[model samples]
Target: MKVLHFLSFFGLIASLSLEAAPKKENRKPNLIKPSETSQTSIENSFPKPKDQYQIRLIMENDAFGGFSDQYYTNGSRLEFNMKAGESNPTRRVLGYWNDLFITPTQSTKYLQGFSLGQEFYTPTNIEKADVSYGDRPYASRAYFGNSLTTATEDTSITTELELGMIGPSVGGKSAQMNFHNFIGSPTPQGWDTQIPNSYSGALRTDVRKFYHRFFGTQYNLNLGNIQADASFGLIFRFGNVDKTPGPGSSALQPGPPILHEDGTGYWYFYVNPGGTFQFYNATIQGLMGSDKSYKTQNRNTAFSNWDNYLNNPTQEAGEREIQYRALAEDNGKNSLQRYILFNEFLVNGTSNPYNIGLNYLLFNNIFNGAEDIEKSTRLFLLNNLAEQWDQIPDNARALAIYSIFRPEGGKLPPQIRLYSYEVLSQFILDPKQREVLLQLLRNEIEFRDEKTYVADLKRAVGFIKVGFVSVSNAGFLFGVHYNYQTIDFQSGKGLPQQHQWLGFQLGKVF
Candidate 1:
C-alpha cells in the first residue's frame, strides 16, 4: 500500500539522518572571515547580546472564516540559550582588513547559536455532529529541542527541529463500567439493569507507541522591526495501543484490542503506520524589550515598552510621543511582558500573591545530577502547576511555597535568589497586596527553618504557571492546515476523517 511505502521511506530517512549528523558536524570547516579575524575593539565587534532566555505565548486558530468551523490552539514555547556564538562581521572583496588578516579567527561564521526548551499546547475538536464526522479531541504534548539561529544587523532567524510523543488517547473514555458490583436485569435498551448485575467492568486500556514521533522544523525570522515565522513537519505514529508486553520494542507490537463485557465478542484495533505533515505561520509587531535597566544603559532611552500603556493609552499627545520614542528605540515589542508580570505578581512568593504572610514556606535550591527521585518529583510538580494554575488548592500552594524557599546548609544560588526578587518586585498595583507579599518574604514562618528548606529544595524543584497577553504587528501572515486522518472503528468499520482550516493573522512585537 502507498501508506506502507511512505512509512518505510520516512523510517529510513530518520535512521540515516540520525546516523549522519555527527559526521556532518566533523566535516564543518574551521575557517573564519579574514577581516573579522583581525583584533578589533571588543565594543565595536560585539552587538548588544540578546536575552539569554525568551518566553513566547502564542494562540493560533484556523477560524478566519467562522468560529463554527475551525481548528483552535493555544500554547507557549520557552527557550534558553545555552551558548551564544559570536557574530561574523561583513568583509570586503579585497579590503585592507581582509588582506592583512588572512588567518581564520573563528570556528563558525554564524552570528548566533542554539537554544533548548519546551513547547506545550492543547488542540480541540469542535465540528458539528450532523455535518461533520471527524473527531480531533483536545490533547496535550510537551516537545523539547534545540534551535539554531543566524543573526544579522537587522534580522535574526532561528530554525528548530523538535520531536514529541503521546500515549493512549482514550484511557478514560469508559470509566463508568463497574464489574465488581453486578446486579443485572434487562433495561429498556436490552442491557442488564439489576439481576444479572448491571455492570460491565472498570477497564482502563493504554496503547501507545514508544515513539509517537512528532518532528518538525520551525523558521522564526525577526527582520528589522518585523517578525515572521513558519514551520512544516510530520507526525509519525507506530506503536501498540494497549499494555506493553514486557521488554520489547514498540516497532514489533500490534495495535489496541477491543473487549466485550459479556464475553460475546472480541476485536483487534490497529492504525496503520502513517504520518501527517502540517505547516503554520504568523507575524507580529510591537515593543521588544521590557527590562528598564537594559534599555536605559544600552540604548540611552528613558521609556518602558510594556503593553499595558499601549493597549490603554491616554488621550494626551505628550504621553503618546514618549511611547512612540520608546517603541522606536526598543526595536520591537516584548511579547512575553504579561507572562513575566504574571510570574512576578501572581505566581511567585512565600504564598500566593493574594494570600501572603499566611505562614507559608519557601525552598530555593536545585537537585544534583544524580537525584533521580528529586528529578521525578520536580517534573510532577511542574506538570501539576501548569495544569492547575488558577485552581490550585491551598494545601498544594503551601507545599510548593515551602519547597521553593527550602534552604541548604549555606547560601542559596545567586541566580535563584535574584530570580525570586525579580518576580516579586514587578506588577504590584495594589499597596495592600504589595505589603503582604513583602512581609511574607521578609519574615519567616514558625516551623519552616534552614533544615526544612534544605530537605525540601533538595527533593522538589519549584515551578509556577506564567501567563501573558500582547498585541503586535511584525509582518503579513497567512496559512492553511489539512489533515486526512483515520478514525477508530466507525460502525464496526474503519473510515477516513478530514480536517481543514485557513487562517490569516497580523500582529506586532515589542
Candidate 2:
C-alpha cells in the first residue's frame, strides 16, 4: 500500500510538470519567397511593422513615361520622395510627398505630393513671336504611384492614369487643330435657309476659339519572366458654340457629329500630314466627325493668315471671296455659300511631326529576373507611337537603342560582338541617352552577383518599383526597384528545398 501511494505521488508530479511547459503558437511569420522579387524584392514574408516611413531620392531618365528610351529623353527627372503612415502594401493607407523637378521641356519649380495631386503650367513665354500657335502650359509631364508590390508575390498588375504628352513622338513634333465654335449648328434646312445668323451671311462662322483636353491610362503587368505594358485614352474639345445656327441662338449646334460628355461637345478630327481634307477654311459640322462644307463671309481674310504662295489656279484666293466654286440650287441665299477644295498638306520630313491615336501598346518588355537565369527579350510592334514603327529613320532608332543599351564608361561589353564603337558613335545623340545606358551597365557590373541584371533591364525601360522585407526579425530592410522582375518557385526554380539550401543570414535592420 505504501509503495502504491509513492508511485501515485510521482505520477501526479510528472503530470504537473508536463502541464506547466509553454505551448508553441500555431501562427508563424510569413517569409518572402525567392520568386516574388528580383534581387531587390523584400526579403521578409511577414508584414512590415506599422507606421514606418521611407524616403527615396529618385533621379531617372526616360523610363517612367513608357518603355522606350526616346519617350522622355528631352529632360531628366529629379524627385525627392517620401512615404508616411501605414507601410502595408495590402492596406496602403499612406500619404506621399514629392518635390519633382525636370529641366527644359516641362520644368516644375516647386515641391509636389499626393496631397497636391497634380499641378498645371500655363504659357508664360508669350512674348516670343514664334512661340508656336498653340503653345500652352501643361501639367502631365511626370507621374508618381506606389513603388512596392501591391499584389501577392506570385503576380502583379499595376494601372496608372496620366495626361499630357503620353509618349514621345517618333520622328518629330505632331500637331492637332481644335476648333471651338460659339454658335449653334446649322438648322434642319441648313445655314443657307437661315437668312440672318448671329454672324449673318458670314458662312460657317460658328467657331470662336480653340482649346483641348486629353487623358490617358497605362497598364503594366508582371508574370514571371514576362512583363507587358499598354496604354489607351481619349482627347476632347469644348467650344462656346450652341446646337442651332442663326443670330442670338444659345442652343448647341444640331448636327450629325456624335456629341459626348453628357452631349456637351465632341471630338473634331485627328490630323496628320498624310491625311485628306475636302475643304480649307470651311465649317466642318455634320453627323460624321469630318463634315466638309464651305460657308465663309470673308475668304481673303481667311487665306491672308496663310501664305500667299499657296494661292494657285486650282486653289486660288480672293479678298473675302470664295475660292472654290459655289454649290448650285441656292434659294437666293447670300447668307451661306458652299465650296470644295480637295487638299492634303505635304509634311516636311526634316521637320519633327507627331501622330495621335486613340490607343497604343507599341512597346513592352519580357525578361526573367532570376539571378541565375538567362535574360529575356524586348518586344516591339510594327506600330509604336501610333505611327509605322519602321517609319522612324534607322539612324534615329539606332541612336535610341544605343542610348538604352550602352554600358558604363560608354563601353560595350567585350562579350557583345556586334557594332564597334567607331561605327555606332557617328550619329549625334542627346546627353540623357547615356544615363539609361549607364543604368543598364550598373546591373551587369554591380548586381550580377545578386543575379538581377534582367531586373535592371526592366528598370532601364521605365518600370519603377521598390519593396522591403525584414531580415531575420531584427529590423526592417528595404530596397527600391525600378521595375518588377522576379522569379517564382513553382515555375523557375521549383520548391526551394530541392535546389536552394536552407541558410542563415545575420544582419541588422535599417
Candidate 3:
C-alpha cells in the first residue's frame, strides 16, 4: 500500500510536467556533416522539425535502482536516456510533439519499451493478458488506471509469516492446536495483502479456534473478518468443539443421571463423543410389575434399586437369584424400555415466550406387536404427555409423552421422555422495534426404538404435573397439565372433557 501511495505521488508530478512542458519551437542542434557518404546522407536527410525548443527538468525517484539527477535535451535525450540500459534517469525531461511522427523514432521506441516495463508492477488480480492498445510507456508512468484497477501497482513488496497457539489450554498438542494461513491480495491503492491478527481460547472441555481464510461468508462487508477469496459472497464460521472420552466412559462417568419421577424407569442422557454423538434417546422399553418381590430381567427387586450403585448382592441369594434367573430367561430382552414421539411442540405463539411441549412415544397401530403391552405403555405415556408437554420452552406445544413400567422391578411406572428444540427468539417489540440478538438451539436425536415390548398396565393411575422450566436464552416454559385416572379400572373409559388443565406457567417477557 505504501508503494502504491509513493507511485501515486510520482504520478501527480509526472502528469503535471507533461501538461506544462513548453510546446512551441526548438533550436536546431549544431552538427558537422559526416565526412563519408553513408553517414552524410543519413545525417542530412533527418526530417527537419518545424519548431524546436529548449527542454529542461530535474527529478528524483527511489523507484529506479538508484537515486540521482542529470541534464537532458533533444539531441542528448535520444543519445543517452533513450539508449538501452541508460534510461535510468538521474533526472531528465524530454519534449513531446503534436506531429506523431515528429517525435523521433528513438523517442517513440523508448516510450514503448518504458511503458512495458511498468507492466511488471501491474496488480495480479487484473490480468495483463487483458491489456491492449499497446500503450507508450510515456502515456502513464504513474500507472494511475492500473492502480485503481488492482493492488499490484507497487514496485516494492514485503511479506511476513506467522504461527501461534489456539484453543482451551495454550499448549503444543493439547486443545490449543491450530493451523497457519498466508494471504496475497491487493489494497485499494495497490499493494500486497497479509494476515494482520489472530487469537484463541478454551472453555472447559471445549476447544475454540479463530483465523482468517481468504474467502469466507461475509459479502466482504467486514474485510478483516473473513478470507481474501471471500470478497463477493464469503462466509467464515467460528467453531468450538469438546473432547470426547473413550467408549463406555458414559457407563462409567455419565455427566448427570436422569431419574424417573416414578420408580419404574431410570433415564440418563450420556454425553459421549468418542466416534458419534449418541443421544441414548427414548427407545421403546417394558418390564412386568407385580407384588411377591417385583420380577424383571429375571431379577427380584429385593435388593438392586439405586440408580448409581449397580453393585448389588453378588451371591445371588433369595428373590435376587430368582429375579436374576427370570431376567436371564427372558433371552436378554429389553423389557423395560421407552419410545420416542416425533412431533413435540414447544412455545406455540409469536408473543408467548412461556410455551408448552411434550416428548412422546407415538405408537404405530400397525407395529404395536402385543396389543396388551402396547396399550398399557400408551396409556402410561398419555398421562406423562398431558402433564409435561408445553411446559418446557413456554412457546411451543407437545403432542404426547412416553412412559415405561417394569412390574418385575417393583418400580412405579415412570415418565422417561420429553421433547425440546433450540429455537431463535425475539425480545419484546414496541409494536415496531426490530430484534438484535440471535439464539440457536439444536435438538438432536440420541436414542431410538430398537427392541420389542411386553407386559400390561395393572390399573390406570392419573396425576397432574406442576412445573416451570427457565431455559437459558429463550425464556421460561410453563405448564399446568392433568390426565384422567381410571375410576372404573375394568373396562377403561373416560369422557374427553374429563381431562383438566391442572397447572399453568408464566413466561419471560424479555
Ranking by lDDT: 1, 2, 3
Q: What does the lDDT read for residue 484 in candidate 3?
A: 21
Tens-digit lDDT string for candidate 1 (409-501): 122333333234334334332565445444443332111121110000011111111111112122111112222222211111111222222
Model 3 over residues 1-510: C-alpha lDDT tens digits? Answer: 655565567668867996897765785653654345335444565666332111111111111212111000000000001111224221122212112212233322121111001111111111111100110000011110000000011110111011222111222111101211111211111111111112311110111111232111111111111111111211122222111110011100101111011122111122111111221101001111212111112221211232222334455333433432232221111223212111111123245333122222222111111112345555665565456554544332321321132221111111121122212223222222122111111111111121111111122223222222222223222222122222111111111211212222222212
**Candidate 1 ranges with C-alpha deviation above 4 Å:** 1-55, 62-65, 69-83, 86-139, 151-157, 161-164, 167-510
| Range of the 10 consecutive residues with the lowest summed lDDT in candidate 2 | 362-371
lDDT value for model 1:
0.25
Q: Using TM-score as the measure, what is the rank order of every candidate, best first? A: 1, 2, 3
Q: Candidate 2 — which residues are off by over 4 angstroms?
A: 1-53, 60-148, 151-154, 157-510
Cα error of candidate 1 at position 252, Å: 30
RMSD of each: 32.0, 30.2, 35.2
Q: State the lDDT at 507 in candidate 2.
A: 19
Question: Which model, 1 or 2, shows the larger TM-score?
Answer: 1
